[model samples]
Target: MKKTTSFVSIGTIILLLFIHGCSGCKKEAQNLSDSPKKTFIGPFMNEDSILLYVQKQLECGPRNPGSNGHSSCKEFLINFLKTKADTAFLQTFSSMVYGRTYEMSNIVASFSPDKKDRILLCAHWDSRPFADEDETPSKRTLPILGANDGASGVAVLLEMARTLSISKPNIGIDIILFDGEDLGLSGDLNGFFQGSRFASKNYPLPKPKYGILLDLVGDKQAEFRYEPLSQQAHFVLVDNIWSIAKERGSPYFIHETGNSVSDDHVMLNEQGIRTINIIDVNLVGNISTNPRRTYWHTSRDILDNLSMQTMSDVGNVLLDFLFTTSDSVY
Candidate 1:
């Protein structure tokens, strides 16, 4: 994911105000319900299992396109998804970067394919080819391991898949691990989100009602805020997820709005898919006060810098949201 800008547009502020007003009305409507709230039971997410998935991805080395690690990791992810998902496959495409053509594949796994009501969960799986943000000038040309930027989100989704395999949700779920998300050079927006661009153009059958994207979610000091683009695309879905986090007393999901990001979700939204990004924007660009921001696109983004507890927090919120909410809620 790339930080497009630190400032929010005027239109976004107006939209946010409108949403806030509507939320008040919705709350009033909910208060009139005499029926008691239903308890949502979801499968437990094991932190140890999630960490192991991250470790296994790192074991394959940097997953940059045209590298051996890329090929091996692709095989590993596809095989693992096949074991758990009712239907799992790869969407292959080609892209030209820096005057060279490269082959890329987006790994997709579907649960309860027959169900028409569906939601999409996605994250980028490819590591950056160059550590452009590394403090050391010499290391800028080297590839990063992307323990938090890439592997973290994928790890959470893999764990979700494992649990979903054990206990199915009422609604259909689609997990897509988008490739080539970190291929862009500094400030080159066109080079990013190649896999998402292709996938959005050729959407899967039985399209999802809404989508959530996870990125940089494993940092020990991760703080997720409302991304403006997400709120603009589907403010109700964003409010619903955040409200769930608030109910669960999650410290990671902040109620305040954060910086806008140019990521895979942006590509999907452009294609008319209402997608929101759950990412730690503070750990990405210049506005961050967190010390871990140093690890962005750097060699320092290793397994040691990640926190299983942080990933579990985000994962649990997703589980609760998926299991508790009905199709009408979103």
Candidate 2:
């Protein structure tokens, strides 16, 4: 009877253990099989150090093309880039807006200048002078802080300069902090992407093998879906980046392709360079004010709403790609 009792107790223990194992397996499968997952890694962990730097730009007031803030920020940027880059230069040009010619500056920072093979990373640092997305028409003419729209992309590139300045990646990297991307009108549908157009036209260096343009990347739950044109033009680049995103476990890096956006990359593509825009295309119904931050071009685009997490997610994928990219490809 003692032996029988012992066998019964052992059987009960085995059944319990089996049930627990099956439950755990089911949970793991469900979690692992889900689409639209996000990832992170060591490189992105370092991005926190740069969020404040981005915020400081927002604090400098509106960096509109012709304002004192814009002039002051240009000086600050030239000084900052000089420290992290082997060479930094300003590309100046004039464009007529509403019959008034405005002087625009495109800040270019280069790392590993000696390496012939290079990749271009760019973002427009200028804040939009109008808050067209705002409900109030009066505020529509006011300049926006552009914390996420402008600064987030700049912040990532700035950190990239700081990081690569020391480590020195195998491939040459050009961080083109573009200007005047947001100042445009529908009457002339071609008014946007000014910096890229200028840079592509007057690239002092050999055309980079490829370019990655970042914009509006600071949503708390940001989703980076592949732009349709990018998919068609630079599918491999898109695929590689998506693979890295999957490996990193970042929440905002979605696997599916989203709508095609005509942004800074369009000019580069038109110039015969392979380029892709890594924009936040999570503009669904009501996720934000206009769904994807309808507050986009508004005064409401302040630092308080910016998420350090989103910055980290983008920075991680960018850094990994930069350091790991092969020189032969270029």
Candidate 3:
């Protein structure tokens, strides 16, 4: 996805505020009550397993749309999720990008399918078709391996799914692996988020209450600041997740506000899902002090740049929030 100054209009912002205000009042009243919080014990996210999942995706090569790697990875993800989740399926559609009509599918896996209260966790599984950000102009046309950009988030969720299969959470969970997220050329917003736009329009039953999107999150130097769009769309969700990270003494989840990103979560928020993104803000945009910025959309985005410890931290935080947090908080 590309960076943008603003996506939501003033009128839309006001409507969102009104909607959130009504719900916020009810949650506030619930928070005031002296209800005991639930305690959850589950298997720890294995760092080795997380690394193995990332390696498995990279083994499929660059999963760009219409490529052999994309086809293989799609089957692998679907088959894997089907074994772990209560229900898993594909949402298929065709879209024309850069004058080419490509078949794409969003891999969706649901846990506790009958539960009314649920949350969403998602990541793009498709790698960029071209390394537009490569410093070597000659290499710009090649596809990126996307170990960090694509596979990392999916790897974390795969591990989460494995753990959830063993120990179910109180609330339902939907893990969606979005396709064609990086098919866009630089500055071409319409080419991006193809899967999210479609999924938002055709939501599944037992819709999620809120969502947390993971992107550019497995790099060794990754730092997650409060993304502006996420903060504006769902401040409470952001605060709660960040608070959990801090309580765990995490060095990655910084409390300061960061850059605005136009990503898949934007599409979900537009559909009134109130989703937030947990991304390495500096690495995605043009400016950054981190060296990993050079890897964005570049052929250098390989398995060497990923960090299993970083992925585990993100997964642990989500598990804590999902299992321990009271039902009323959601």
Candidate 4:
């Protein structure tokens, strides 16, 4: 009887221990499920960091091609890019815009510059000189603040530069902040994309596998429709980005065709680099009134109009595409 009782007590102890061990395992598994999976290679884009970049650019004032703001912002960007990028290339050149000779610098920064396989990302850092789309005719003559039109895209790239500096992927990445892109008249294609045209004409070494140009991407109601030229240049590439946006549940990367924009990407494609423009062109500005996002080339393009969420959504989509893709983006 004593032996039987002793055996029963020992069995009960083992059962309790086993139950406790199983409970711990269940809790551990639950925690693992709750945490983000490590399979995604991209860094978590800091929206605050992105916001700071935008604010810094705007503080330099309207970055018109030859204004004091332009000179200060150029210095700021070159200094900033040097800190983040592995190798910085200052592509300085003289260009003629509106019958005036202006000196421009296209700042190109690279991560893993030695790698032959590369990807290019670019944006126009210059703001429009004319508020031609402003409601008041008098205001039309003044310059724009360019919080969204110029700073937003550059802010995204700066954040990406911060990301690459941290956990750089196996691929080579080149980021170019172009100058003199917004100095042209609307009807004339020849004058615009001056920095891009110059860079393309003298491409610093071989081109990347492909490139993405970001423009007007920081509106509170930002909507990135696929530009027609991007589809024409790289149909599969456009599809790939749109598909990634959908998969990531990004609210603003609408899977639709946007208006044909004669942006910096045109020069890159003409140079045979296979680049695409990711611009929010829903900006329907009338002769007088401005819609929510239709403030292009206007003084209304202020810092308040830019949204941190919008910037985060676009930046993350790009990061996921470049970092999480099973194959190369080419």
Q: Which candidate is the best by lDDT?
A: 1
lDDT of 2: 0.77
**Candidate 2 to truth, TM:** 0.84
Tens digits of per-residue lDDT for model 4, 51-132: 9999899999999888999999999898998998998868999987777998888988999898888888899998888898
**Which rank order by TM-score, best down to worst?**
1, 3, 4, 2
lDDT of 3 by residue, 1-330 (tens): 001103224434654576567875655545433232222365579999999999889999999999999999999999999999999999999889889998999999999988989999999999999999998999999999999889999999999999989988889999999999999989989999988888888885567889899999898878999999998888888887887787676789999998999999999999998899999878885477656556888888888888899999999989988886624465
Candidate 3, residue 275: how far the Cα is off, in Å: 0.4
Q: Write the per-residue lDDT of candidate 1 for residues 102-156, one digit (tens) a residue.
A: 8999999999999989999999999999999888999999999999989999999
lDDT of each: 0.87, 0.77, 0.86, 0.82
Candidate 2 residue-wise lDDT, 1-330, digit = tens = 234336646765765676677985755545444433323233443656667678668767789889887888888787899998999989899887677677999999988888888898888999878777677888977888888778888888888788777776678888898888877864454677788788888886767889888898887767788899887778888877776677667778888978887788888898888888888865421244444365566767777667888887787787766666434333
Where in model 1 is the C-alpha error above 4 Å? 1-39
For model 4, the superposed segments whose C-alpha errors exceed 4 Å read 1-41, 284-290
* Poorest lDDT segment (10 consecutive residues) of candidate 3: 1-10
Which candidate leads the pack in TM-score?
A: 1
Reference-based TM-score of each model: 0.87, 0.84, 0.87, 0.85
Candidate 1 scores a C-alpha RMSD against the true structure in Å of 8.6
- Which pairs, if any, clash in model 3? none
- For TM-score, candidate 3 versus 4, the one ahead is 3
